[model samples]
Target: MNHYNLSSDLELVSMLKDGDLTAFTEIHRRYYGVLYSHAYKRLPDSEEVKDILQELFICIWNNRETINIGSNLPAYLYTSVRNRILNIFKHQKIESDYITSFLHFAHQNEPLADEPFRIKELVAIVEAEVSLLPPQMRLIFEMSRNSYLSHQEIADKLNISSLTVRKQINNSLKILRVKLGTHFFMLFF
Candidate 1:
């Protein structure tokens, strides 16, 4: 058996600071179980508890040349584990808050349950009003609105002047505005 296993924590810490691997190993062996139990009480996850302890030990080893535990190794280890557990809790809360905010925004932007039905009814009314227009005017309006054609394009297709196509589209709009009230017409057009 290694004699380091019986060394006092202060002696171990001094040896650890002097780059003695055996003292560091003894420190880990003596405190790992207590630290795991302490951290597991707060964190509850075995893997997370293990990782925190592992990282703590790695930090101690890497900074052994300048590590200052002031002769109380267990206090330092316990504090390190406690701080890591608190950080995990803080990160989880942030993620939870972000997810909750995203869900709230998504719910707010979702259409009302009857929105699709209302939209269909409005489209039917608009189509009925558009169909009532004079035949040539209806054709020009449908070309402009449905086919997304420009006035010049409609005029070229129908063998009419661009000015006549524009007038027909304007007249169609006026007729529809009179049939479907200004507020209702504006909703669709």
Candidate 2:
């Protein structure tokens, strides 16, 4: 029988600190699924969830020399995952606020027929701005917004991770926000 199979997390962690590859592999085998599931619950994007988990493990490995988990490894993992999720949410909120701000500006300043006309203009602006995105980001953005595909759907179709699909979409939005600036409100109100 493998002693590692019966070893406590603290023991495995100590071994990991000593640069034990087998111990690290064992830890990965033990917790990767649990961590992945936890991340998926908070983030619907599978690719993002995978990335988050992968990053967590990679961080652990890279920092193994200095890593310290005082007996509660599961809690440590959960906390790390939670923090990453919070950061992702914070970024999403910022992007959402940009959209909200644009809407408010349009509501306050634009008129009846002007609203529709402005929408058309905004569509044009978005198209032009989207064209400016890197090819992959633009493709993902269009797949999501124009083709109305879900992240998982896009990932499957593109043979990429859903996380990559989401990141590209977010990047595209950020670029649009910056390029369109206050003018976005004039286009989409």
Candidate 3:
């Protein structure tokens, strides 16, 4: 039997197209080193370089029937290797973009991690101060602010004039402002 190692590129390609495994193995042995060296120059990552070359060989085998290596198999192999490297770079870029976006999203929402607790604490402080208000003023303030009732609605419900409800709410606000000071409102608003 003739040794496949001595076969020409055209002969190997022909044998590969004819589904000869020995010819494909010989082609892999002949071209793998040059292709790997060429790929490693562009990508320093050893594993990635190996993966690209392995994929290149698999592509050759899988597409052997359709592949037409007319005269220059070396040129074809080099082009294939170069194309695969380009695709790896493209995929790496997309992955890098996704990771950047994810990190930005996490950074942007980081404040939210503390927000709920701060809101709860502020609400408790306000509630404690509200409890210190005289009974009627507290009731009216809760109705207007907490229940979202208008001045007219509070007045009508309490059998008081709209002006009294407005005045009482204003007084309650003044007292709370003096107690809680400005920082609470600044945070909430």
Better of 1 and 3 by lDDT: 1
Tell me the tens digit of each residue's lDDT in model 2 across 26-59.
Answer: 6775566556655675678899998888899999
Ranking by lDDT: 2, 1, 3
Question: Once superposed on the true structure, which residue ranges of model 1 sit more than 4 Å away at CA?
Answer: 94-189
TM-score for each of the candidates:
0.48, 0.49, 0.47
155 in model 3: Cα distance from truth in Å?
A: 99
By TM-score, the best candidate is 2
- Candidates 2 and 3, the one with greater lDDT: 2
RMSD in angstroms between candidate 1 and the native structure over all alpha carbons: 34.7
Q: lDDT of all the models against the reference?
A: 0.65, 0.66, 0.65
Better of 1 and 3 by TM-score: 1
lDDT of 1 by residue, 117-172 (tens): 65455344434454444546455435633355667876776677989877765664
RMSD of each: 34.7, 21.5, 35.1
